[model samples]
Target: MRQMGRTNRARYLATFLLGYALSGLLTGTWTSVETLMDYFKYKPRILCVESKTKPYFAICPFHKEEDLLVSGSIRDTGIWDSDLTHLLKVALSLYKEAMLVDLGAFIGYFTLYAGALHHDVLAVEPSNSSFKRLRQGLLLNDFSATIKILNKAVSNKRSYVHMGKNQKLNLGKMHVNSEKDTDDRENALKNEMIETVTMNDLLEYIHVKQAIIKIDIEGYECKAMEMSTAFFKEVFVPFIFMEWLIIRTNMNSNETACTWTDAKRLVDYLTGLGYTPFAYHPVFTLLDPSAVLDWEIDNIFWQHKNAKSLLPYINLLRKVGPKYFDKMDQNQV
Candidate 1:
């Protein structure tokens, strides 16, 4: 009986140790696999994504594809900016044909979409990697001939400016640092010098009689607006779609920060030029600029006084609902 007890004890100890070793090995292997996937997931690739409008090929970074473009149930459904695209379609329907200026065109989703719909598009991108992808996407979708590509940053001036430091993990956050006030050497070292052009200069070059302007240049919208105040007064841009950011309350700099003050100034400027602001909450509703408290949403549309006749169309958009998905086929080039 004593001998049997000793053998059983030895077998139990061996089993416990073996189980612990196997668990540790499996855990380590899982962690390594996850790390490897994260590192390689964002490498650039060309993917065919089905958009709400039409099927198009997107040259997407692994991060954007995994996180934003393909996160939902449908792959590359173009739902990422469905609201903006829907609004664009409504605007185009109002005007038989119009020119679209996609400032900060990124991977040219909006730019290529506009071109695919037979609208003339001016797509601007500043980052080298993004620009290359935008160009590739345009070509992939056969929009190269339809859209004019500009590999430069948009600002209130025509000069060379330092591009924002690249945050490899989040390329969309890349912005231009015009202030040059940061003391971080590492951040400064990451900046690349890029050509910048004013909205006035670009419009002059394009010479479109009336166009729809879409601005999504991070937080630089105010600066671009400030520089193009004269152009706003002189030209007849029927629609201005922009992403507005709340200004840093702590910011004491005289530079444009798209803060409340900057937003107020923009309101005054646009209203002075007979333009009205409306918030696009899936549907266009008149926006009281004074009531806006934060930059929580991404889409705002400004209508020229001349385009007030299009207000009824807003209700039509609301009534149509998800049926707009079918409209994409109707509008496809």
Candidate 2:
């Protein structure tokens, strides 16, 4: 009976291993192999990596929270958001004097990359923990002089808002509540009062006339943009990469942000400003302005339609295209 039981257990183990191997190959997710590769990418004690040779970027290692975002790809996967990063390079090429603005900058992945590229940068982070980490990353990369960080929220008004942190994983992706709305008693104690600034104020603070901006400010992007009509009309923002995956209509249950009407308001506003739309996911795709916009896409790219200098580069992007294949580079760190 004991011999029979041992044989059954062995058979079960063999079946499980075989199933895993087949599934991994079929789904293109070989977790064990990827784990081994990421393991060698960074030194465990230091929590930082290099791009080629010189020290590139450092991350906040507390619960490895910073790694949960774009920095994770930069450190573990050997590649970051090459699409947006590449697009940034292209825009910077067009406007040589423009600055890179990373709004809601989580530990400064894009900001660090831009700073390393030797461009002036402004990284705005509202969360305290993330702000501290972003500053540390700048100091580590030796970009303190060129890259300035603002510990404030980008909002419709220049006032204080209550922000609650995601203690579970991301300390940066906080839940912003208005001073008028105090219904969330659960996270009330955890919520901190953070000062807010408008998009115009941000650009003015950095003395940036022409700018390339990345907006990842939770779901307040629409509100901020709506409030910054004057800034958008006056500033030379040739390019903007904005987070489009909305907070949904029912903010409490995690559904759409307010029927598609609210999102349309945002699109209409941008279109009125002479900006063309593009989606960042499934590659850098050019979106038809007349078609129905999908708000579920993670990120959206907007380029000035009237900029004469932007015409050629955008046409070339449509012709050649950018690839985001996360290839394992041996010296990626």
lDDT of 1 by residue, 1-333 (tens): 011134433443344344334545765523233332332333213332334455332333334433343223124344456666766766765664678888988777777767766788888888877786576555445554567888888876666667777664456657887775343445544655677778776766465566788888877777677788656655568888887642333123565456666767767877788788877775466777665564355567888888735465566667777465445453342
Deviation (Å) of 107 in candidate 2? 0.5
Worst 10 residues of 2 by lDDT: 324-333
Off by over 4 Å in 1: 1-45, 48-52, 55-76, 166-169, 181-191, 233-235, 246-256, 282-284, 291-297, 328-333
CA RMSD for every model?
Answer: 16.0, 14.7
TM for candidate 1 is 0.72
lDDT at 139, model 2: 47
Task: Candidate 2: give the clashing pairs.
Answer: 50-333, 248-255, 248-256, 248-257, 249-256, 249-257, 249-258
Q: What is the lDDT of residue 56 in candidate 1?
A: 36
Q: What is the lDDT of residue 207 in candidate 1?
A: 53
Clashes of each: 2, 7
lDDT of 2 at 232: 69
Q: For model 2, how does the per-residue alpha-carbon lDDT over 41-118 read when each residue is reduced to its tens digit?
A: 333332444432122344433334543555455545444565665566666656767788888887777787777666
